[model samples]
Target: MIKIGDFNKLKVKRKADFGYFLDGKTNNTKDDILLHNRLLGKNNINIGDEVKAFIFKDSEDRIAATLIEPKAKVGEIAMLKVVAHTKIGSFIDIGLPKDILVPFKARTYDLEKGEKYPFYIYVDKSNRLAATTDIDTYLTTDHEYNVGDTVTGVVYGFQTNNSAMIVVNNKYAGVILHNEYFTELKPGQELNLKVIKIYEDGKLGLSPRQNRKEELDVLESSIMSYLEGNDGFMRFNDKSTPEEIYTVFNSSKKNFKRALGVLMKKNLIIQNSEGTYLK
Candidate 1:
């Protein structure tokens, strides 16, 4: 019942100059795991002393335990930095001596060295620790989340239709449809998303924007800043295209117009066929 890739509590059977041999619960030294000298961690352990450690295979493929914690364990998600690459896959530094492998097929983009990305760790078919950017298979749609609830998530992949696939709370499946944002989102970007709708299939539809009033507050402030920086006069108006509005404000045309309307109502600005200008 020795579970690799997880923390295990084992008793010391014997000690050696190299390290202590942990009892594998089988009463056999050959079946014992070696807690190497470097992993002793200042503890003067003796036989029959119970110690907790993370069990894994060492460089020699021998069962080993360490007091050091990995950045992420199997069945968990973490942000890891790419340190090196091979023809078959890339390795990420996961706070362990052996970097975890992220195969090319499991990557959303061509991973480059020195770049950090969100990766989900799991045991591969060979029972070796591996990571992947394709995390949908690990995400569940059934969750207790409700509309309007705020949750944290990471962008793992993009749909061909331009939607962003998100894993919410590291477990629930969610997405931000193409119409939700004016800017392009990339993989591995973390977001604090607001749940907009819970689909019939239990999937969540999320948005990055807040409610209308709160959105207007932000947009209004943005407009004021732009006007202030522009000497109180600007040329963009209702005639501006969506792309133009997005380029200037990083917001949708509808939100831009709503912000303009509020400004005009406050008598802070006036608009004509030519453009909008501060009064």
Candidate 2:
């Protein structure tokens, strides 16, 4: 049985000057399938040979089979190798007889051949399967997000402001602000970040810094280790200056004070007019 918009393996029942004819029953009627000559030029296909064909619509609105596989469906991500380039666009070999086009307008920069690029496969207004290099413009979903929401992203490039340009879920390109960056980041790096904001223009904001739970845990652990390693005593008065606290813990004075407060709350230490000491 033949169905529209489906893949089918059919046998070549006959041949003609224009193409080969395939026999298959569709809705209990004998239908003739046209496999164009130009489409089989690369292969030596002959009568009685089984071939795979994708059902496509003809100009007469009839179901026709093509030797070319189906085009990339919407919302599909694929890694394709660059095959050639033209002034208007680059062609990518996406496991199909016909290469997909990546238009110049869809690119952030010029592309070169012999390189592999990950792209979201989409059909353009012209009904052609094309690749997009500028992915940020495509992620325009009405999804609600907020600060401290854990998300994953891939580093794409760097910003002059010291922020890292990242791609999230191949849907959006967002900036991880410099101040929010806590560790080293490089291009192609895949890391987890917290969503700092969802801009009105559909761009996402990310932060590499720890969230509340992680920050608290790190602070507590650092303070406990510092206190235990130092004979259970920390000069927490005027002598433990902000600079000294930062040098010791890589944290601000306020965070040091909060860690001290946690130690006091846990009855692990005591503070006096003289200085903070072990109880």
Candidate 3:
């Protein structure tokens, strides 16, 4: 059965001067498949050679193929080696007769032949497979992601706002804000993170470390040290905001509130609704 918007395995039934004809018998409708020589090259495609091709509309609205290799598919991420560079784009040989085009706009840096680069494969408006370097714009899943769900990702680059570009699970690329990136990060660096938000678009928001119980303990100790350093009386309400808490403790306001709540409950500190003072 031939399916639209997908590749189908067809048997080469006959060879012609212009192309090879494939047979399709499904739903009692006989459809002729054309494997154009221009798209397939001069290679002799014999009868019964199972070829994988994507169905597309021809000039006459007939279902023809664009001759996609068995291995290549839409929404796939691959490490393809660059074969040639044109004025408009670079061509990658992803086991296809016609190398896939990675448009200049989709490229992050200059591509040279013999070098392998990771890219996401997608079908453009023209119904042709194209490669994109911007992997962040495409994400399509939503699982049970919590605030501290451990995740793994590769650092793509950085944003002007100091967010780190990361490809998580090769499913989607996302940003780990500079404030969220507590540790050092470099381009192409792979690290573990925690899920901050699972966006509606299926893109993930990430954080560097999971501020678990132990982490909170360390942060509480730091706050105590800061108070001790200030002669046991610290006026920090004016200075402690969400940003400051993140910068100093690598935690959120809720976490800080919880930590301070614990301290206050233990009578280690005193609060009078104005601010917290060391006791």
Pick by lDDT: which candidate is best?
A: 1
Best by TM-score: 1
Q: All candidates' TM-scores? A: 0.89, 0.47, 0.49
Candidate 1 has what TM-score? 0.89
Per-residue CA lDDT of model 2 for 51-116, tens digit only, reads 887654454544466776554444655445789999788988765546678988877655668776
Error of 2 at 166 (Å): 2.1
Encode model 3's per-residue lDDT on 1-279: one tens digit a residue. Answer: 666446877778878898888776543335777778876744557888887767654555566765744345677765577889898899887665456789999988666688766678876776666787676556445455665678887776688887888777666656788767565676556778888876676667897765668767876787778777877765555336887776766666666777777777788887664566788
lDDT of each: 0.84, 0.69, 0.70
Clashing pairs in 2: none
Please say which candidate is ahead in lDDT: 2 or 3.
Answer: 3
TM-score of 3: 0.49
What shift in Å separates residue 180 of candidate 3 from its native position after superposition? 3.3
Clashes of 1: 0
Order the candidates by lDDT, highest first. Answer: 1, 3, 2
Provide the clashing-pair count of each candidate structure.
0, 0, 0
Candidate 3 differs from the real structure by a C-alpha RMSD in angstroms, to one decimal, of 9.9
lDDT tens digits, residue span 54-152, model 1:
777666767788777888888887778999999889999877667778998988787778977778888777667789988778788979999989999
